[model samples]
Target: MIEVVSLIDAAPPRVFDLELDMDVHAGSLPGSQETATTSTGRRQLALGDEVTFHARHLGLNWQMTSRISAYEPPYHFVDEQVRGPFRALRHEHHFEDLGDGGTRMTDRMSIHAPLGPLGAMVTRLLLAPYLSRLLRQRAIHIKRLAENVDRRR
Candidate 1:
């Protein structure tokens, strides 16, 4: 399990909308080159939508499909991996309005690796920290974009 929190200098709706933008997401990772291939391959993703992403990570090309199993605009959403490397993966996103044109974003991720004990060990000793860094990077990107947009407005 992993959790990340970010404070954005933008309204909840603005932050929420930016988070759902596929292009924004694709460009968030500097070197991963992640792209949405299929399923809701649009600017914004909605409930019940599925998206397939192809990217290079850890010197390996990987693809994963995930579905937006739950969504509540400007509030909360959840995406669950349908087909991916992990045995199970679910990510929950929450947005809270700060009542002052700001928003608090929280991300919680739960992952279950395959191959039993070996995978568990790998997840604990390696994957967890790697994912934490990745998530922090992503959140920082989002925060920059959101704040920049605010500045331009």
Candidate 2:
């Protein structure tokens, strides 16, 4: 499991709404060349929505389909992989109101690689750290956007 936490200088509703925006998600991982399309072809994801992402990662092109298994507006959501490189992957997003008009965002991912011992080794040594960094980078991107930083100069 990989966990990442970020504090954003914005209300929970704003942070949560941005997190559910597909365009923000793609923009956050510019280096990965990630693009996503939802089952409903909507820009925002809601309960039971599925999203398919195509990207280049770790020198390989990959595709993953994940469904929003659980969702509670402005508070929590879970996306579970339906098909992907991993044997299993479930990501949980949590937003907490700090009562100072700021939000605390937490991301927890449970990933299981395919195969047996070899897969376990690979996940521990490589996938875990790589994914952790990826999540952290995403958090930073979201934080900037939530704080109203206009980077398009």
Candidate 3:
């Protein structure tokens, strides 16, 4: 499991809404060429929503489908992969009000590599760190979006 915590300079509800916007994630990460290919067209994702994505990782193209199995509005949400390269993948998002117009966000990811020991070794030596950086970058991107969301309001 890889966990990331971020203090976003935005209200909890604002950050939560931005976090659920799929469009914000498009092209947010470097070199992934990420795109939601199926089960989408909605403005924001909710419980039971599934999105299939295609991206390039580790020099290979991959496709994964994830379902929002759990959602609790401006508090928390969980997305689990139904089909993907990994043996298992679950991402949980948690947000709490900071009492100062900001939000404390926690992102927890549980991932399992295929091929057992070899995959585990590779994950520990390479994949985990890479993913950690990727998630942190993603968080920064979302935080910026959330903080600036109401600029036109």
lDDT to native, each model: 0.88, 0.95, 0.87
Which 10 consecutive positions of candidate 2 have the poorest summed lDDT? 144-153
Off by over 4 Å in 3: 38-40, 151-153
TM-score of 2: 0.96
Off by over 4 Å in 1: 150-153
Candidates' TM-scores?
A: 0.94, 0.96, 0.93
| lDDT preference between candidates 1 and 3, better one | 1
Give one digit per residue, the lDDT tens place, for model 2 in 1-153.
899999998989889999999999999999999999999989999999999999999999999999999999999999999999999999999999999989999999989999989999999999999999999999999999999945354
Q: Model 1: what TM-score?
A: 0.94
Kindly indicate the candidate among 1 and 2 with the higher TM-score. Answer: 2
* lDDT by residue for model 1 (1-153), tens: 899999998888888888888888898886998988647456689998888889998898988899999999989999999999999999999999989889999999999999999999999998888888888898898898888873554
Highest TM-score model number: 2
Ranking by lDDT: 2, 1, 3
Better of 2 and 3 by TM-score: 2
Model 3 / residue 139 / CA error / Å: 0.5
